[model samples]
Target: MNTLYRLGQFSIALTFPALAILLAVFGLPAVLLFLSSLNAPDFSLTNYEAFFSRGANVRVLLQTVEVSVIATLMCVIVGYPTAYIFAAASKGLRMALLVLVVIPYLTSFLVRTYAWIVILGDGGLINTLLLELGLISSPIPLIYNRMAVYIGMVHIMLPIMVLPLVSVMVGIDKSLSAAARSMGARPFAAFCRVFFPLSLPGVLSGSLLVFVLCLGFYITPAALGGLGDAMLSTFIAAQVESSFDLARIAASSFVLLGLAAVVLGIFGLDLSGAQDSRPHPAWKSPPDWLRSFGAPTRRVKELAARHRAKRWASTLYQAAGRGHLWKVVGTAFVALVMFYLLFPSVVVIIMSFSAGPSLHFPPRALSLQWYRSFFNNPSWTDAAWISIQIGLAVAVLSTIVGTLAAYGLSRTFPRLRSTLTMTILTPITIPSIVVGIAAYLGLLKVGLIGTKTGIILTHSIGATAYVVVIVSATLANFDRRLELAAKSMRASPLRAFTRVTLPLVRPGIIAGALFAFLHSFDEVVQTSLVSGFSVRTLPLKMWENIRHEIDPTIAAVASMLVLLPVAWLIVFYFTLWRSRPTVSGVPLETAS
Candidate 1:
C-alpha cells in the first residue's frame, strides 16, 4: 500500500508540470479556435457555409488533398525500396545512408523548397541543360505548375516516409525469406510471400505520416507551384491576409480540421484491424530437462544464460551477413536516394557563391559577391533576426507545453489517452495555412495582428503539438520507479521532478525543442498572415523576393539557413551519442 502511494505521488509530481504547460498553451488555443469557429456575431455555422459556397476555396481544398495523396504515394513507392535496401545493407553502409537521409531533414524546409525554384524555373538548370543538349527546343513550363509542386513536395516528404519504413524494416527477420526459399519459392516469390507482408506495417505507417505532413505543406508548393497550382494552405493565407474575411477564415479552418480528423480516424481503424488480424504465435517454455540441469543454483543458471546468449548473438551476426552482389546493389540504391534528396540543396549552395546577378548553378566565375550583397541588405538581416527570435521563443514555449501534455496523456486512462493524443496532434493534421487563418480571425478582436508577440504566440500554438507528440514518445519509455524513489525520500512533487525526472527526460525535451524551433523557422504561411510589414520572417522575406525576382542573394541567404540547422543536428546527435551506453547490448529505452 505504501509502495502504491509512493508510485501515485511520483506520477502526479512528474505529470503536473507538463499538464500545466499544455493547458496554458495547446488546450487554451484549441478551445479558442473551436469557440471562434462557432462564435461569429451569433452562434451559427456561417463560417462553414461560406467555406463550402466558394467554388475556388472548395477546389483548393480538393487540390490540397489530391496533391498530398499523390505525393504520399510517390514517397511510399520510392521510400519502400530505399528502406528495404537500407535494411539489407551492412551496418556501416546503413548508418551512412541513414545520416544522408537525415541531413536533408535537418535543413530548413523553406530553403530546400527555394532550391527547387532555381532548378525548375525558366532558364534554370533543368531547362538550360536540356536546351544545351538539344533535348528540347524550348524551356518547359515546370515551375508554377502541378508537376513542380509534386516534385518539390515529394522531395521534401520522401525522407519522412523513408525513416519510419526503415525503423520497422530493420526489425524483420532475414531467415523468414530463407525459410520461404527452402519451401520451393524463388527469391522474388519468397520476398513477396514473406518479407513484403511483414513490411506492410512500415509502409502503412510511413504512408500515413507522409500523407498527414503533406496535407499541411505550404512553403514548397507555394514556391514551386505559384499561382497556377495554389493549394488549400495558399488559399487560406490569401483569405486571411489579402481578403481579411474572418468568418470565411474560421469556416475554412474548421473544414480542414474535420477532413484531417476523418482521414486520421480511417487510417487508425485500418491499422488497428491489421494488428488484430495478425495471428499471435503461442509462447513455448524451455525444455523441462534444460531447466532441471540449470537447477536452482545461481552458477548453473548463469552458465546456461551465457550459453543461450552466445547462440543468439551468433545467429544475429549470421543473419546480418549478406552476399556481395546484394550489398553493392543496396549501396547504390541508397546513394541514388541520398543524391535525389541532397541534389537541389547542393545546387542552391553552389549558386550562392556565384558572382552573377541571376541564379547560376555552375557559375562562370565563383565569388562571394552575393553573400556580401545579402549581408549588406538590412531587410534580410532584420528578417533573419525576427525568424531567430520567433524560433527560439517558440522552441522554449512549445517544449514546456508539449512535455506537460505528454505527461498528462501518459498518466491518463488508456482509452482516453488515444483520444487526447489525437487532439494534441491535430494541429499537424490541419494545414498550417488554416491555423494561420484561424489564429488571424481569433486574435483580430484581441488585436494580435502584425505584432511579434502575436506571431510568436501563433507559431508556438502550431509548434506545441509537434513537441507534445515527440516528448510524449520519450516519456512513454521512462521508468515509473525513478519518480517513486524520489517521492519515497519525502521530496515535494516539484522538487522530485526537477531533481529526478527532468534530467532523465532532457534528451526528449531537447529533440522536441529542436523540432519546434525548426517548425517556426521554416513556417511561412502562418507567418505571412500574422506578421505585418513591421515583422517579416526569413521565409516571408524569401517568399517576397521570389515573387518580385529571383537572385543569387536569395540563394546565399538560403545556404546559410540550411547550414544552421544542419550544424544544430550534428551537435544534437553527438550529445545523444555521448549520453548512451558504450555497450552495444545495453537495452536502450525508446521515446515512443
Candidate 2:
C-alpha cells in the first residue's frame, strides 16, 4: 500500500509545473503589490498615513459596508423565496427557471450593466412609458444613484444567493414538512416551524457570499453610480489612473484585500455552513389551534354531501377563500421575477436594431444599422478577433492548470483540501479593481505592462479560480473505484487516471473550460489596466465606448456576445440533459 501510494503521489507531482506557473504569475504579483506599499519615502508608511489621514477616505469603508449590507439584505428578501421555488419546483419547471437564472449570469457583465442604462436612462423605456401615460411630464432620474447601483448588484448577486441555498435546501427532508402538514398544521405554519429552520444555513451561506462580493464590486457601481455614490472600487480605479505612486496604488489594493479578508474570517467561506454548526431540531409541536390550518376546514365529504348541484357556485366561492387565491398570487410573483431577470437582455437586443441613436426602447423603425456599423469598423472587427483568441488561450490555460490542481487536492484528506481550495480561490475573493492594480504594478516591475502576455497571465490567474471551483465540485461526486480497478490490473497510474478517471470527469472539465472562456472574454478590470497601448479586446472596446457615447454599435456588440454564450450554453445544457447511453445504437431507457 505504501509503494502504491508513493507511485500515485509521484504521478500527482507531474502537475507541479502548472501549479508553479500559477504561483509565479498570481503569487508573485501579489508579493509585488505588497512590496509596493513599502516603497514609500525611506520605506516608511507614508502611503498608509495618507489613507488614514483623510476622514473622507475612511468613509469609503463605512460606505462600502453600508451598501453591502443593504444589497445583501435585499438579496435575501428577494432570493429566499425564489430559491425555494427552484428547490421545490417540478423537473421541467426547475430546468427552465434555472436556465433563466443562469443565462444573464453568464451574459457579459458590461452588456447586462449596459442594459440597465438603456432602461433607466433619461429617454429610456420606463421614462418613455410614463410620458405616454401622463404619469410625469419628464423622465425620472433612475440610473445614476445608489438605488441604481443596488438594482444592478442584486440582479448579478441573485444567482450567487440562490445556488448555494438550493444546494443545502435539496438535502433537506421534505418528509418533515409533509408530516407536519399531514397532521393539522397550515402550510405556512408547517413551513415556518419545520422547513425554514433547516434552510437557514443556506441563507447564511448565500447572504454572506452576496455581502462579501458586494464589498468588492466594481462594474455595476461604476457604471450606474454617481460621484457621491462611488463604491470603494470606483476610488481604486481613480487611484490607478491618476498616480504613478506605486505605494498609493498598493495601499488602496491592501485596504480592499484587508476588507475581503475580514469578511472571509467572519463568514469563513463555507457558505454551505455544513461543517461547524447547524440549527438544532429543537422545535416541538405547536398548540392544537396552530395545527388546525393544515387540516382543511369543512371536510371534503361533508361539503360534497351538503352542497348539491344547486349550490355549486357557493362551494366554488368557498374553495377560492380557502387556498386558491395565494396560489395564484405566488405563481404571478414568480412570473414577474422571471420577467425582471429577462428584461435587460430583451431591451438590449431590441435597441441593437434601432434606426436612430439614443438607445430608447420601441424605436420608430427597426434596422440593421448598428450591425452594419459594427462590421464596417476595422477597429471593432480587429478587437473582436483579438478577444476571441485571448478567450481561447485563457480557456485552455486555466482548464489545464485548474484540473491538475484539483486532481492533486482531491487526492488529499478533507481538511487539507479545504485549506488549499481557499488558497486557490484567493484571486476571486479580492476585488477585481485590486487585481488590476496589483497586476499593473507587478507587471510594470517586470516590464510586461501594455503587453498581451501580461493580460493573458492576469486573466488566467482570475479565470483559474473558477475552473478549480467547478472541476473540484465535479470530482467530489466522482466514483474512484474504477481507477482502483485499473490499478488492480497493474495499469500505470497515468493510464489509470486518463483511461478511467478523466473520461468520467470530462464533462466537468468542458464546463470549466467554457467558464474560463467566458471569464477571459468578459473581463474588463484587469484587462483594461494591463492592455495599456498594445492590446485591445471586445470588452475594452465596449468599456471605452460606454464611457464616451451610448452608441448602438455597443448594443450590437453586446447582443452578439449575449447570443454566442447563451446559444452555446443552451446546446451544452440540452446535450447534458438529453444525453443517454446507447446499446448497439438504441437508446437505453432512463427509468425515473
Candidate 2 lDDT over 331-433, as tens digits, reads: 7877877787888888889888888764557767899988999999999999999998989999999899889877877787667667666767777776777
Candidate maximizing TM-score = 2
Taken over the whole model, the C-alpha lDDT of each candidate is: 0.74, 0.79
Per-candidate RMSD, Å: 10.3, 6.4
**Candidate 2 residue spans exceeding 4 A from truth:** 1-7, 10-18, 38-45, 182-186, 271-323, 579-592
**Highest lDDT against the true fold, candidate:** 2
How far off is model 1, as Cα RMSD? 10.3
The candidate 2 region of ten consecutive residues with least summed lDDT is 583-592
Q: Give the Å shift of residue 136 in candidate 2.
A: 1.9
